[model samples]
Target: MAVYTYTVDNANLAVQDLSTGESLTDIFTYTITDSDGDTATTTLTITIDGVNDGAQQGAMKSKSWSQA
Candidate 1:
């Protein structure tokens, strides 16, 4: 049997959303190694959707809402 662990860091991620006419990129990478001296690596990309609220907060907000 083998063991694996993963970690993430987003200190440099953009604070804007894609729906606000802005786009951001987040890259993820992982590596695995076995006791038999075998190693493998992989990468993944992710994109988040922005809210369409009618108000602008000068930056990306964690929450948003509208009144009818």
Candidate 2:
């Protein structure tokens, strides 16, 4: 039996920007090695879909006013 090991050159992927009906593609390289010291490398392509996020808010304060 041959034991195989897999490795990825880059595993840290950034999140895609928010858009309407848009997607992003990211490419990376990976390698597979066997117990016989043979290695196979190839490029992998991944697609990231766009999503909608809720609005961001900041801190709020209260003030008092008087009228004469």
Candidate 3:
């Protein structure tokens, strides 16, 4: 019997500064090691979709203009 361990190069794969209607793609490397010191590596792709935040948008204000 052989024991195998799996690990990801990037533990924190969170997206930052993403805005609405924007998308981001990130690639990460992962490896699997066996008790015999044999290892296999591959890439993992992650896609993050942006969302709209209503609170971030301010309320619309109305203004009136008069002619002098």
Question: lDDT for each of the candidates?
Answer: 0.60, 0.62, 0.65
Worst 10 residues of 3 by lDDT: 7-16
TM-score of each: 0.42, 0.48, 0.46
Model 1 TM-score (2 dp): 0.42
Across 1-68, the per-residue lDDT of candidate 2 in tens digits comes to 53544443333343434465676677878788888999999987876666565554653467899999
Per-residue lDDT of model 1, residues 16-64, tens digit only: 3236656555677878888898999998776554546576677565888
Clashing pairs in 3: none
In the predicted model 1, the residue pairs found to clash are: none
Report the number of the highest-lDDT candidate.
3
User: For residues 1-68, what per-residue lDDT tens digits would candidate 3 score against the true structure?
Assistant: 53544443333444434568787777878788888999999987777776664554455677999999
Which is the better candidate, 2 or 3, if ranked by TM-score?
2
In candidate 3, stretches whose alpha carbon ends up further than 4 angstroms from where it belongs are: 1-21, 57-68
